[model samples]
Target chain A: MEKIIGFYPGCSLEGTAREYNESVFSLAKLFNIKLEPVPDWNCCGATAAHNISKKLSLSLPARILSQAETAGMKSLLVPCAACYNRLMVTQHELFENEELKSEVEEIMGMGLNSPIRVLNVIQFIQEYIYPGLQEKLSSPFGKKVACYYGCLLIRPHDVLNFDRTEDPQTMDEAMKMIGAESIDWPFKTECCGAGFSVSRTDLVAKLSGKIIKDACDRGAEAIIVACPMCHSNLDMRRNTIDRLLGYKTEIPVLYITQAIGLACGLSVKQTGIQRHIVRVDWQRLNSCLPEKMIKEEEDIHG
Target chain B: MYYALYLITLLSKYMAKEIYQNNAPHTLNNDLFHEIGISSARCYQCGKCSAGCPMAEDMNYTPNTVMRIIQAEDRQMDLELLSSESIWLCASCEMCISRCPMQIDIPKIMDYLRQKSLQERLQDKAANKSIIPFHQSFLDMIRYTGRSYEVGLVLDFKLRSKKIMQDVDLVPKMLSHGKLPFLPDGIKGKKNIQAIFKRTLRKK
Candidate 1:
């Protein structure tokens, strides 16, 4: 029997980051792990609720956790860093304040029952995929990449308590396991002006441009990330980023799952590589793989 | 000596009366402490938070200055901090709290301050006008569809902010890549989500 974990892709994964959704499912299929979507799950409210109302922030996540608990799920995999942070922080806040918990319960119309364990993409990979990753690698992804953790994945240390706040190494370690040389670059945990992507694209351009420039200057071929928001800022906002830098920095951003999927012999389309706004340099990525795998991929994709 | 002691007591009582008369500062401070359990008084002007803040350069007042304003415990300073663009501009990256020697949760305080600013109708004083509208549009989408509809959110934001021409060029590209879905994927629990919103608002 395969292990089943509740999966919450969040809003971005369904829309702007559909490629992330495809890559995550494809990678999970290889491991035979069943990623069950939490039934009738609503939005985690993201940055909006917290900015507007504290009660809404706690209540939104509490409802999602309750749904997961009702489904008999002991663990949930929240791939989006923002959702993961909201869920984890909500649990911590509710546990610390009984008054708030009861108020949230009243709003949720359900008892905040057994706390479901929430896992981000990195933690999920570390637990289930990393253990069996070595045996499944068909070819090493021999490329230098910067692992961008962004914010929310590891901050408010006492609440999330997953990785180091500054210069996090978990994503780097995971990238190394898949045969990619993780570069030592600053801005691993920098804010990409996340929620400001739509409201203040200029700010996102400035902040994300610095991250891209640093990665390129440090000789990184690609920037790998786990968050869709970071992927959007680095990949979707490439034109703006380039405008800010006064030159084009054509470094493609790949999700961690997509990078690992390539190493595990998944096709480019399967990993949703073509969905990216910044055209991925297929020739360069192919050059890093084994010759036979490259031939096979070319025959199928070409 | 007896006369001197009487005069000292009179001076102390006068100062206490003057401080109590100006109750706005304590109300703001006490509200923050009671709501979030974080006191701005804990900030000791280390400037570490401001130094590490990514948005400090863009903000009207740096993170430390906002802390100092709250620490001053003056009515004028409280209004200044609340109306300042620093609160609205905070990305809530938690860099300050992570490195603070006193472990002050600046992001949480920013959230509280933003809510207070809106409640008091001090949002007009915010220099960065689009942030609040974006947040409102996002929540509105969730409240309606029980999920964030990107197309709806962008349209709603554009309507609210009246920046209609912004990002128009990216729509075709997004559509071609299937990044922007024409329709929102609504959850079956839409009614439940609305109820949650209503209940939270009623409490407020």
Candidate 2:
């Protein structure tokens, strides 16, 4: 069966996290998974909308879900964890309150009666992509990675309810299938001072510093993430994090899709690995791939 | 067990009434509860929420204290909680509500306080002035493009907050990596987004 899921790249993927967007598309193609982007999807309200207006926060994500339904997609793949949380939370709130549902539908001028399943990137891989990942892999990535869930992916377990809230293993499990050794770390689900990546780099420095330090102390070579917010805090704000650490930390943060793509013999350039601020040592990771696959990658990338 | 539960409820009401009398005179309708649809009075002063909060150290009042203030219905206390940096600092991590024995949604309550603070124009009086303008810029970006435009959001936030140099150094680096696009893109259904905003106001 050809599995097709609606994709909502969200705003971060369009702007700050285009690398994430590129890798997700490439990985989906590699897995033979078909993705149809939801037409003209709006923002998911992220961390700001609720502060402005609760109705807008609910209505914005509700509109996206309705759009997915109208597009004839029963399952929507939201790669950004924040967007997934917003969509899932809106559904949970609406299901519990018919009054709020009607109000949201009226406000957005759309009906959300058709059930749409919202899956985060990790869950999408675990369900559809994981089954055939081993046969597709041309390399055993073999790098010790710290799987970071940041704040939203699994918290408030009742609403998001995809994995264990305190100790999520889905990302780790996926990494293992790609031949990367995932490390057990304390900061897996810790807050990396998300939106503060831009507004308050100092706060991000302090929070993300702890997460990076823990990953390094545990002997991980790189950090794996599903949220663009976490990637920005961990990768883009590295200078602040390093400044606060009083030493340089060279741990590269890779979106899980990029990591999976690399293990599946996707070119580093194809996976957007070079776009990261903290430069990833792709040469070291490439040696873990099958020799023929490495030659092929060199031929293609060179 | 039933008798004890009833007694505890009565005691809480009496305690709340006593606190209301000593504070500023404002009728405590069920507005906060109605807005959040969760009762803070259900919180039994458990420090679990505070213990699990990643930003609790930065908060002047812990999550439990904020809940107590709302439960007491003290106008002065409510204002203090609303104006504190803590409410703005919450990442909405939802650790509190998930761990709450009473299943109280403390994050929702904090969101309500933040909303009330913004509505009442208390941001200038609050400890964190940085988030106020950023929030406005974010909403403005959404209202314009039906989604966030990163470069536009940064420019608008910097201009509005007057923190022009905030992360200015990262602009060139971001541009080099294609992180910051100079042009903003709009969804085709932007008019529908504008309609959503307009309807939200009338509903409010």
Candidate 3:
């Protein structure tokens, strides 16, 4: 008898990082774990929603959890940090506030299961997905890589409470399972200035430049990101950083899943390497990932 | 380019010594702060908000320090580059707001400072060139269309900003894999979105 957790991957799945969504699903099958999808979901109302109303901000994610509760899901597994934070905070507030639970029910038309649990993708994988996946590791990545968590995933302490939000690398623990090294560094949870990458590109570029510079300064081979928004700012915005800093800093940025997927015999192309602006063309990276990941493109496309 | 030079010149006076005082008549006075729903009086002067702000170390006055100034009801501090970056640098991740003991929505205050700074063009020295235009283009897109059309926003931001050519080598690959969409498709009920945006002036 295997346990199946309810999965709530946010809108990024619909675009940007479809591979992550696919990789998680495929990896679940490999681990003999079931990931049932939460039905009829809406946006988690990330950084944008708080501007509207704090109550509404928390309730948006709470509505999804409420749906999960109605469907009898004791715990919900969320992939995106922004979503994980909101959902987890709602769970925290609901359990803490007796009156608010009934108030939220009247607003959302559903109730959270008492003691409703919300786990980040990394948290869930580290606890449930790591052990079984560890059995299939074909290579070890002792490469010095900075694990970037950035803001909501770890901050405010009360919500999610996974790791030190400022300098978190719990992915280092999970990365170890698939046999990869996670460099311990200070810039892990530093803000990439994600949303502002568009509005205030200059600030984002300078800060992102600093983040990459810190990782490179510490001799990191690459930077691992879990959030698509973070990934976009840190990785895709490389050209902007280069123009601002007047140098080429082509550091590879991969979602943790892609790294694990590569280690577990998934292909580089299969991990969505092409979508990255700063390509990870490191020789050491080449040596750490398994041969299967390298040949994966040929196998799938040929 | 003019704004960037303008901001740098403002920070030029701070070259002798970064004075924490720049006197500019700001709309963020006591009454205005209340109008925006940020109560400076409630802030405990705990530098946590400043400490948590990603751009605080680089800023002249931190979000926490700004709150302290607003709390003590002292409005004489010079907050040029610091306030601008403090507000602009906020990713709006709400870390400061979430952590505040008094539960002040510092991010909103930060947005006000950011908008003011951008409007005044006072502290634009190191504005993320690519990031800002990308943001303006996106806002313009949303302003034109109710909700964002990711494909449209991406295409226009890149094309208009002249950055598409920089990444043109990679666009072929992105388009090949369907990572970049060909059309600008937006949310169905755009009128409702327009109403929302029209009804509420976020920082104005």
Compute DockQ for each candidate against the true complex.
0.73, 0.59, 0.14
How far residue A121's Cα lies from its native spot in candidate 2, in Å, is 0.7
Interface RMSD of each: 0.8, 1.2, 5.3
Q: Is candidate 1 or candidate 3 better by DockQ?
A: 1
- Segments of candidate 1 deviating more than 4 angstroms: A282-302, B1-26, B125-128, B202-204
Task: Please give the TM-score for the first chain of candidate 1.
Answer: 0.93
Clashes of each: 0, 0, 13
Compute the lDDT of residue B91 as modeled in candidate 2: 75
Give a tens-digit lDDT track for model 2, residues A236-299: 8988888888767778899999999988999988899988998897456423233455578789
Report the lDDT tens digits of candidate 2 across residue range B1-204.
999999999999999998987773452226765555676667789789899888888888888878777778777777766667888888787878877888887888777878887777665343344776677788889988998888888889888767888887787888788787766568899999999989875432
Off by more than 4 A, model 2:
A282-302, B1-29, B124-128, B202-204
Top TM-score hit: 1
Rank ordering of all candidates by DockQ, starting from the highest: 1, 2, 3
TM-score of 3: 0.71
Docking class of 1: medium
Which candidate leads in DockQ?
Answer: 1
User: Of the candidates numbered 1 and 2, which has the greater TM-score value?
Assistant: 1
